[model samples]
Target chain A: MSESDIAAAFEDGPAFVPYLTAGDPTFESSIEYVEALERGGADVIELGLPFSEPIAEGPTIQQAIVRSLADGMTPVRFFEFVETLAVDVPLVCMTYYNLIYQYGEEEGPRPFVERAAAAGVDGLIVPDLPVEEAQPLRTACDALGVDLIFIVAPTTTDDRLDPLLEHSSGYVYVQARLGVTGARSDVSDHTSHSLDRLKGYDLPAAVGFGISTGEQAGEIVAGGADGIIVGSALVDIVADGYENDLSVEETADRLEAKANELTTGITEQGQPRSERL
Target chain B: MSETFGRYGGQYVPEALMPALEELTDAYQRYVLNNEDGFMDEFRQRLETFGGRPTPLQRAEQLSERYGTEVYLKREDLVHGGAHKLNNALGQVLLAKYMGKERIIAETGAGQHGTATAMAAAHLDMPCEIYMGRTDTNRQRPNVFRMRLNNAEVTPVDIGRGTLKEAISEALRDWAHTVETTHYVIGSVVGPHPFPQLVDAFQAVISAEIRDQLRERTGALPDSVVACAGGGSNAMGTFHHFVDEEPVDLYAIEAGGSSLEVDQARGVAPNSASLTTGTEGVLHGARTRVLQDGHGQIMESHSVSAGLDYAGVGPELAHLVETGRVTPDSVGDDTALAGFHRLSQTEGIIPALETSHAIGWLEEATPEQLGERVVLTVSGRGDKDLETVLEETAERDIPAAPQMNVFSNPTTGGDGNE
Candidate 1:
């Protein structure tokens, strides 16, 4: 899988994307959970490379990251986890910029991007890296035939949006709300407005942040998102199972069921409003 | 005009904060640099009347006799809030007002910056809140009370060792959620672009005053200037005006807590010497020297003083140390405790534990190393450190400590020191 694979996944229809920390409960359990997502009809799987400080995440994902790091997850182990997963869909490595900046002996993004390419990872999503300081990483990802995805907040102005569109590859992560990543009970009205802002850009727009349920995912897709990215919703399931002392098979079953419900909603919507019109 | 110090500083934050940083950058250019709408003028005037600017540069007669040199103290301990923290806190709160912000938030480790920011917000009539680690709240109880007295809400962070780093992460999280109507007053010269530059510009007043006062006292600048480095605010302020002087030297003393050795298995470094033993990495929105493990995870840092217990240093200070413009050194906890007592007993001026790190370095240096004339910033008063000093001094065999048994039975009836 590569950047083209991710772009192609969105071309067919509104894609269903799910996220999980690479080593949330443990390394072996995480691989099974990711494979379950693939079986549940995921188009792109985002594997969180847990960073020590995840400033962009809210309570749910932040707790998930802590659990992952406590399990002794590292950059080397994350790449090895990526290589071990059996999913055929595009895999995106999501983490903070420090892990990417301090990867190898030499400092910069190239060494990490190079390693990601070699490790069979398809894309990179750095939540803490703004578009203004993303040129080096953008160039590196482009050179290595990987995709660099940028998140677009509703507050992102034209000055920032222009550079973001120019630099972003694979897709643009359209933030569904104003705050950090978390599971919200209600869908934000800002999702449609955010997608409207990205109408001029040529990249696929995947709405994320606070989209927790099948109904919310369906509403975002029906409102014109090219895809829907869900994180905290799925991570909550894993955390609940871990706390309840559930077996790996039980947790993986819940993940697959949740992923199926989300993808079923997106598929039931048939097509995005923009694609239909 | 540039946001970076060499290749060190940049705005490495989430997209949600980009707009806020951009607005702050514009304000920083107009009000801070260009002084538009008399922003800098009002800032200076307020600092003078409210913060008590131009703190005395007193010649330490006893220290001069001990070191055989003309040792001077930049008396920032006399500042209104009892530390140099107000220089940046008041400046930022004023800047937030100029930017039309309605609320103020900040993070603190030792509670000094929290107290300063709280006072600034109250003086300016802006609603304020401060985030501090739960561990710090238990230790620095008096300063926490001072912040509450100023009417600022103190939010205790209960994650990841409950220290400065965790407090900063919590503050950043709040700023991301409230960036539209609130301003985050970062306590140190760390963080992303505009913050390091903004905090440094406000703190530069310390050096600016030091240079003028020293020139008024003598005819020339001192041969060397020394200040302790946690996030390197006071050190940067003390060294900012003298970086161009070819003859003057700069020293940044760090807290060498139990040892310099990093416990890789536990992911902890027993010291907070980022400028001396840290690797270049990104932390708290800027790329700087960070105490991290081989896997790029920021390690837990420790210090006797909460103010100096941080895992990362300011980018500008890291750049200066990298370029050989400033010398990096460290002193152990016991040595700093002795220095704390040495100053109190000899000069009748009790210094903060963080400031004592610099004074402790003096004992480790030779006469030639300090040169003929030396100046150091007394960053804060030791009132906030009385409890910490009492506890830490009791555990160690500090020659300078008077007598631990004097206060051993405070609750019950006890005899005098005699």
Candidate 2:
């Protein structure tokens, strides 16, 4: 797979991007969960390779990380988890910068990106890696035919935005709000303004952060996002399964149902009601 | 103007914090570097009147007699809040006022920085809140009360071992949400670009005073300077003015909790000696020396002193150590306890447990290791550490401790009449 695969995932309609930590609860159960999302019509799947310190995540994802780490998840294990997946959608590994920078022998992101490319991973999203320090990683990804995605927040200025878009590939993560990653009840008013700011850029913008429900996803796509990204809310589902000791099949079915609901929400707003009729 | 120190120190935070960092960089250059609106003058005046600037540099006769070398102490313990923390806290809070920020927020491990920030915020009449780890709050209970007494809300972070690293992450999350109205006063000489430089600028007053006071008394710079390195604020403060002096040796003492051998299987480092044994990795917001496993996972670090329990050191300190301008050393928990007892007994000054790490290194060093004239920073007073000292002193057989058995059984004390 290449960066084009990720860009092409959004060509049909508004893409549904759902995230899950790779080894949360257990590694095998997580593989089932990712495949379930793909079956539910996910265009792109974000596989969170849990880092020890996930500063950008809120409580839900933080708890997911702790569970994944306790299950002995590491960089090598994450790649193996990626390779074990049977899904056909492009997989993007989302993690902090340290794991990518310190992956293999002889320092830097080259060795890690090389291994990730071989592991069937197509793109990367490092929340802690701002555009100022993203050059080396971007160069590595570009050389290996993988995309380096950047998150554009509501507070990102035009000077920062120019470089962010220049170095970005696949899609730009449009942070819907001003805070860390978590689920909120309502869609932020700032989401439209963020989409408006990115209207000039040619890259696809996937709105994330505080987006959970189908109504919220529909509202974001209606506000002009190319895709919708949800993490903490989905992780909340898995957390409920783990805490309540639900069967893997049961949890996987619930995830598939939720993903289908989100995708339906996205496609409903893909065109105007009068044209669809 | 540069954001990096060698290959270290850059903005590694999420993009949501980019504008705040850029704004802070501008403020730092204008108010701090250029003294825009006489900001430096106002900062210095407030430091003198409110935080008690120009702390004394006193020669320790007893320590000199014991070490067989002239020993001098930069008395940061004499500052109004009983530590070097107030210097940076006061500067950042006043800068926030200049930047028109309505609130103040900070994170602390030992509560010295939290108490100091709360006091500074109260003095400047700004609303303040602090994030402290649950472990730190439980150990340093008095400082929590002190912060509340100064009208600062103390929020206990109950995640990830509840230490300085987690508190910092939690505070960053808060700052990301409220950047338009809040200024996060990072406690140490760590974090991204302008933070390490900005906090160092506020803290460099220690070395400035030591340079003048030592030269006035001894007619020369000290042969060596020593301070404890948690996140390396005080160490950098003591070494800033003397960095270019070719003859002055700087020692950054770290806490060796039990041993330096990292438990890679469990992802736990028994010690907090990041400058001594850490590999290069990005943590918090900068690339620095951090205690990380082979697969790039940050390990949980331990230290007897709550202040020195962080897994990562300041990026500039990492650069300085790599460039050979500073030497890093580790002092074990037992040795630091002995240092605590010795200072309290002989010098009649109770040093904070964080400062005791540096004092502990004094005992292990040879006369040649510590030059003829050695200067060390008493980073804070031990008033807040009395309970911790009482509990830990009972566990160890420290020679200098006077009969800790009396307090081990509280009923034996003469407080029955009361």
Candidate 3:
């Protein structure tokens, strides 16, 4: 996972950012899915370590997280798994802040930021940690070479836009709607305008929240979003596959196929970064 | 830092909620700064006309003799909806009406806030939905009926051991989906910023009246002001005006169902003594002291009063606790029940289970040399707890006071109805 790799994806069409809750059915299945996601043309992979209480998740992701947590997805467990995981796409860990803070709570274990960096995570997106209260965590990430991404809301005022994007590393996560994370039928009408507002910033602008399909992903990216995050749709494919008679390999193949289809919808021909900047 | 109280309180919510929170902050500021919309006036008017404000500050003569001190109860129990909860729900619903929000959503623990919110929404003709834990809904059957009677839809949350935290999480989830059309009337002085500050302002009227009432009656402030803390709206309200008075000590009584000590011997975790034994952690979008286990996972709390069975205290109280401005004490379950029974017998006032914690604090740790004056907010009525009380006291061979029997038929020694 490298900064250059993520920037390179943005230089092309909208970088197709995809997410998977680590250890949804099992840790092994999740690792295989990440590798398959990379093969299916994922730009940067957002690996969500499951948490017990996710304040901002919708029914789809909430169920996935519950399943993952039931399967015992701790920060240590996720990090231990990621330590051996190898994928081409830069992996960013996205989850609630509590699991991160509770990481290594026993004695004098290394803090989550450093531990995540050592485990080879490239960036972080903690939806619960606003920039105002994100000092110590930000400092830890900064010292450990982990990028701390910031969130942009549709309700963000003009005065708040620059302040939020200024310190954002890796990329700016643009919340597509005024609600929690779930797949929506269409991209929000305000999303293109949000992307246009982020145009001046040098960071890659990725739109997420309520994106469930390849077409919505395509629409946001075509509307000039630097990337598109397709989470629940892909996670659903895995969940739905594992439900019935599908073997683990069959589930992995179905996930890989769906990821490939969604990837096809969002990515575009490569262009020089200088043209946009 | 601006919205925060000292190092505690900050708006730590999801990105999707920032705009709604900002709007609420702006609206609250306008009411305070301009008051041109007559928002505060309408809220005050409703408090007076509907909820019965300036509730009696009765001198507890019999209880005064028992404790050897002059004790006065700020009778919030007499308020409509039978608790101090109506004061806040009314104010917030008025604000919602002012904001042109057609719907309101709230989360409740003991069901008092739910019933209060439902009552306010019913008055304002707004569609209200309240989230209550399934356990709480079952535990507080009267309030559940009260909410339905007010035409507010009640959603029973079954997640996370079925309690306040889960109910709040479910409410937050609902709010995220409906933030555009729904105004979330948070039940206490907690949650993300603008909420703690705003809810405290709405509830501050309790202390404001107590201050004036005490000053008029005693020619000085009471030596101490005491109130129970759940999410700490009532205690914060009771302590707000007295905070600056050096002579007025503020004591926030927390729920200590069993003991504050985590008993490894019996493998019993400490009670819900959040301020007494909690560590600073973030929950429900605010930084506060939380009763969490060693691994930082929030632990379940036990309390005789459902209102105080929370993992976290209000951040304002957390700040006050850190600064030594408010001393937080935890009262055990048996002691609180004793206070409930004693207050009922002595003063003919059956306090809400939550308010009994404050009385328990007074009895358990009253001064050897009694102070001149004590002001306590009887946060709610205990008619709701009648069955619980009768069942609890059934085992004890306690006799009714001879004086109370004067109303009974002398020959039968039974009900006056007969």
The interface root-mean-square deviations, each candidate in sequence, come to 0.9, 0.7, 1.8
Candidate 3's chain A scores what TM-score? 0.92
**DockQ for all models:** 0.76, 0.86, 0.47
Q: State, as a TM-score between 0 and 1, how close model 1 is to the true structure.
A: 0.97
Kindly list the per-residue Cα lDDT of model 3 for residues A151-175, writing each as its tens digit.
8988777887876876678888988
Question: For model 2, how does the per-residue alpha-carbon lDDT over A1-277 read when each residue is reduced to its tens digit?
Answer: 3338999897777889999999997999999999999998899999999998888989899999999999989999999999999999999999999999998886799999999999999999999999989989988998999988999988898788889999999999999888888999977788898888888887888999988888888888887889999999889999999999999999999999999999998888875322322
Q: List the residue pairs that clash in candidate 3.
A: A182-A210, A184-A210
Which lDDT tens digits does candidate 2 get at residues B1-418?
A: 9999998899999999989999999999999999999999999999999988899999999999999999999999999999999999999999999999999999999999999999999999999999999999998899999999999999999888999999999999999889989999999999988999999999999999999999999899899999999999999999999999989999999999899998999999999999999999999999999999998899999998999999999999999999999999999998998999899988999999999999999999989978899999999999898878776776666778777454446632222212
lDDT minimum window of 10 residues, candidate 3 chain A: A267-276
Per prediction, the TM-score for chain B is 0.97, 0.97, 0.92
Please name the candidate that would achieve the greatest DockQ relative to the true structure. 2
Candidate 3, residues B263-364: lDDT per residue as tens digits?
Answer: 533223458788988887778888889876544556777787888888788999999999999988888877787788778878889898899899888887
Ranking by DockQ: 2, 1, 3
Which window of ten consecutive residues has the lowest lDDT sum in model 2 chain B? B409-418
What tens digits encode model 1's per-residue C-alpha lDDT throughout B1-418?
6878998999899998999998999999999999999999999999999999879999999999999999999999999989999999999999999999999999999999999999999999999999999999999999889999999999999878888999999899999878999999999999999899899999999999999999989989999999999999998899999999979999999999989999998999999999989998899999999999987899999999899999999999999999999999999888998999999998999999999999999999988779989999999999999878876776667788877565555522223222
Model 3 chain B, TM?
0.92
The CAPRI class of candidate 1 is medium
Candidate 3: residue B326 Cα off by (Å): 1.0
lDDT-better candidate, 1 vs 2? 2
Which residue window of length 10 is worst by lDDT in model 3 chain B? B395-404
